[model samples]
Target: MIIRELITHRWGNKELVTSPSFGTVEKVFVKDDMRVLEWEPLFIIRTENGSLEQIAVGVNGVINSVHVKEGDHVIPGMVMAFIKDDLLDSDIS
Candidate 1:
């Protein structure tokens, strides 16, 4: 299952998306407190093989954490960010 669905379901598997290999965070498109749509580009990673990969938000939610910043080397299973699923509608808008 995708990250979005897993998060929405309270992470039934608790699995995370990892890089196929080591890479560095090239760019961050989303920030904390931002409302993101499902599958939106959250960041980009540049692999050692010179390939650029776009990491997208798995679910429609607000960004809660940003673990790695630009130019930071990241490994597989690294938590790039946390997305808090907006499961309920609140009147505090």
Candidate 2:
């Protein structure tokens, strides 16, 4: 699958959030145990082209862990964070 399409994965009550593009993480807006809503901006990345892109968990959840920090270089499909998602298995297609 393409990187952007792999950005989120449903694993029981948890979700994995992955990077969609190659870039440096510019900022992280949440920390472990923080609750977030679907489509909420969780991180901002500065791409190689110097443009910024926002990354989100893509599901409602409490952050379980974060794997990237500001200034870390990320490529497509890199795991950026894990979330304790509220979504059911059927909630994801």
Clashes by residue pair, model 2: none
Q: Give all candidate RMSDs, comma-separated.
A: 5.9, 4.9
Residue range 6-93, candidate 2, lDDT tens digits: 3487656678888888989998998999988987888888888888887765588789999999999999889899988675525567
Predict model 1's lDDT versus the native.
0.65
lDDT of 2 at 61: 72
Can you write out model 1's per-residue Cα lDDT over 18-58, one digit (the tens) per residue?
Answer: 44347898888877787888778777888888788777645
Stretches of candidate 2 exceeding 4 Å from the true structure: 1-7, 88-93
Clash statistics: count for each candidate: 0, 0
* Per-candidate TM-score against the hidden true structure: 0.72, 0.81
Give residue 36's lDDT in candidate 2 (0 to 100): 87
Highest lDDT, which number?
2
lDDT of each: 0.65, 0.80
| Clash pairs, model 1 backbone | none
Cα deviation of 44 in candidate 1 (Å)? Answer: 0.4
